[model samples]
Target: MALGGNPIFNGKSFRGATQAPRVPSYPQSQPGYGQPQYGQQQYGQPQYGEPAWSTQQMSSDQLQQMYKMYNRPSAGPAETGRMTFDDVIVKTAACLAVLLIGAAISLFVAPGTSSLLMVVGALGGFVLAMVNTFKKQPSPALILGYAGLEGLFLGGLTRFLDALYPGVGLQAVIGTLAVFGVTLALFKSGKVRATPKAMRFFMIAMLGYLVFAVINMVMVWTGVVNSPFGLGTSVHIFGIPLGVFIGLLAIGLAAFSLVMDFTSIEQGVLQGAPERYSWTAAFGLTVTLVWLYVEIIRLLAILRGDD
Candidate 1:
């Protein structure tokens, strides 16, 4: 599988799934077996020692019909019910729309209510992300549900942060879109790729980042750090918050992750993966974009806080 970086595509197989079945050919008759002998009956008749064989002569209309059928183009991915770029785009748009709706709902609610929902969204989204990740097949409902929960979390978080730093949410959104667009363009242009070496590095960096995030969360929970972002804001590297560097690295990783997503999606379409798997591709892209958005917003917050 060329999908080493993204766990969502790791175990799925698309080999020969949408290929047309081979047409079987009738065996040609041997010279001695089917040929008329000196004392045998004519064609289409049964001889004394041979079985009867019937030959039907087709009319001109029937011959033309057969010719047309033989010359007709083979079915495409859509006709065969296989995956395509359009399917991925449509499904991804649906997921994003659901997410936006959920976000709008969260933003319009009361602050206290929004905070409560944010917590619920965070926990629920995490659960759904795990479930969707491990599922053998994609479930549209569950994937959309996950997107909705993530939206709630993001909306609440943005509301809280944007209150302190006005326009930061919008900036984050723009930054996320810019990064996504650039990454996609690069991937499409073949200027960037998710090579095996890069993927290995990505895995290592991701693992380290995860560990740091867990430790930071633990510190915040234990009151080990008084800063809102824990070490991210509390520590500085020559007048720059440590988070700025970490955030940049994280954003780069997320961008590269989009490359992997694109690669996997392109390969899936080419390999004729089932149309349902487009939802899986959509889910993966959504997950990456969300992470990118959060990182951008957090980075913006950290920078604004220093000012």
Candidate 2:
């Protein structure tokens, strides 16, 4: 399907999807081949090379049926078992709804318990993400489960951060939405694209980002940095916390990842991907969005902490 840089879609090829069916053609009657000539017919005698029944004239009912069949609209992508934009949208919305429900449940839980669930959510989400990414076909239950876990993680994290920095969660949500809207608009307008060169750069940057994240996590775990954000807050660049720059970079990466997602979905639709693969598309989007939301909220929290 010539998918873009999103790993979820990189190796997928909607194998079993079928194209639209072709219209059936009716055979036309030939004058001399299957029927006797006007003056050559003999009573109770069969003509050579002619069938017992003549097909010289079609009934008015048959003609009308043919006309109706010819004029009937062709099957659409959904009817043909192919993926469509609507499928992606509907499935994505379903995933997000489940995520929101999970978040709401986590948000109302006790703080200490919420933290434990958040940790569980984080670990569980990571495992499911890997599973979904490598699976040959999409599974809705697993995808929705991943989304729900992410919501739990996000809800707990937001609760923790927002308690210390009032309104930060709402601000982060607005920021995430703004970035998403802008990126989508630019993509649709052809102003931004996941070109080959851009994708290469994205991969390189993602690798660096992952390396730094791992290092930061290790430092936090080992007590090498006493700060809540590990080296992000401990280190400063021109009196600005290093995390600020890192956060911006991560958000940018996430935004660009959305472009990759859009590119893959567009290609899938154009190439007649199977309808079931729309779940995969929805899963990819949810993953990117969860990453984006985390980065944005963390950035906001860092800024608020600095203040």
Candidate 3:
């Protein structure tokens, strides 16, 4: 989303959409512009065979007409490397396909093997994510590769969690879809937006959330809190688990992130961003969806943890 430091949309020159040079108007070569029009009489056309033309005899209107004759038609958006809604949809589908393939592979593996896959997928996905994110030009292979790796991670993690919290995976899937649908509707209706003020607030909240996440991780690792879910489990507010509040907040943040993703994609399409960057748009949306799904599932799991 347009939240504080989303590097994907914030990078220079490599961002989703960029300003393109105006289409050019091609003029005749005018090879001998300075000299009298080649092969023409000193005064003007000879009024005989091969009626010659000279630069001196040329009028502004005539020059303009001649130039217009050579001028080329403007390039269409596809030719200009501009983004389109179709490009986003197509590329997103490809990424999702690859993701599902990876996830399928992880799903049926032995429990022991699934655990190993989870670790490998998580680490490998993180590495690939960074590589794809910072590249100046969009790479279909890398973007799809990231999707596949993340699918492995998601599948393994989901399998592990689902074992403990039965039906959480399905619930999360429904929740993710519901949120996506509602958010898209709101965005299309112009009810929800990534306005400057809203984005500022998003960024601040995201930063605070990141800080808390890091501290909580440290606390768990250092045995400061023995809860499996870190401080989210140890702390309670108003008789509910902190994670419920945090998870709800996180879900809200992720929901807004989808808006940012939509904004970026819409901007790219409207700006006629390079067609290749459609992959970028697709990747951005996938990341947001995955984040949203994970948050939703985790929240559900946490709510059912004590049960």
Candidate 4:
């Protein structure tokens, strides 16, 4: 299934306002004398071995004014505070910590209860996720809320899967981490990028996947399929469950989306974008990780069920 909750752009463009430059210090015809000229030597010959004044010693106000005038942060990618790919990684890890804590609580509180934690986590997480995604500006409150919701879902899912297949939760955790780590390394190594062709393929494949998911959900609700997995159980390739193959394809697509996220963050940092967008980077990453985890967990479940 496709990961839900992508941030929506309301089609608003950020317009930077331009103010008129400060008037020239003096008319072109006038001599420069208003500002202190310490570097000036007397019209007569200088006394032997006297030191010269340095611009490095300007007062803080003078330096700030100079920066405002000439070094104004460029409108393009070179804006200040834009988050780097490295920053996203660190933030994502921190968010994951919060998620793990929530999961731990669910596991301990209501062990082996499917609807209890999973429903709470899924519905709660989905609500908070919407709040965070559609928010005009990011808030720590909403982001943390999303994290907690995801944790509950993960914990319940882990407990359920682990009960069926001992240590499966641990395996899934390790697998998720390994995938994220390797994908990041490959992205940083410059061997992978979100090329035009790839993105187009991803969009089309994602659309097809979404349609299948909606149809499956309808089938389940209509009692057309007794299995919880719907069409995945009915369809098979050479005796292999269709869900397994579809899950693999979905995982591949999610992994490539991570690559695109990495590329976008890289461009933002190198262009010097405003630092506030780090939250956007964090959000994108969280979305991908959740998708990855869900895919892995579901794939494991399908394989286990195959037996």
TM-score, model 2 to reference: 0.87
Please give, for residues 1-307, the per-residue lDDT of candidate 4 as tens digits. 0111133222112223123457879555634665434665456544558545446778889878977899765563224344456666677677888898988887887455644878888999888877776776667667767887898888888887788878778877887888888898998898877777777788889999999999999999999989767888678899998999889888888888788777666655654445555666676677788889888887887888888
Candidate achieving the largest lDDT: 2
Pitting candidate 1 against candidate 2, the one with the higher lDDT is: 2
lDDT of 1 by residue, 82-171 (tens): 999999999999999999988887899999999988899899999999999889899999999999999999999999999999999999
Number of backbone collisions per candidate, in order?
Answer: 0, 0, 5, 7
List the RMSD of every prediction in angstroms: 4.9, 5.7, 6.6, 8.0
110-217 per-residue lDDT for model 3 (tens digits): 988888887888888888888878887788988888898888888998998999999998999899999999999999999998888888999899999999999999
- Which candidate order results from sorting by lDDT in descending order? 2, 1, 3, 4
Residues 1-307, candidate 2: write the lDDT tens digits. 4367799886787543554468999887656675766677767877778687644577888888988999999999889888999999999999999999878877899999889878988999999999999998899999999999999999889889999999999999999999999999999999999999998999999999999999999999999999999889999999999999999999999999999999999988988898899999999999999999999999999999999
Better of 2 and 4 by lDDT: 2
Q: By how many angstroms RMSD does model 2 differ from the true structure? A: 5.7
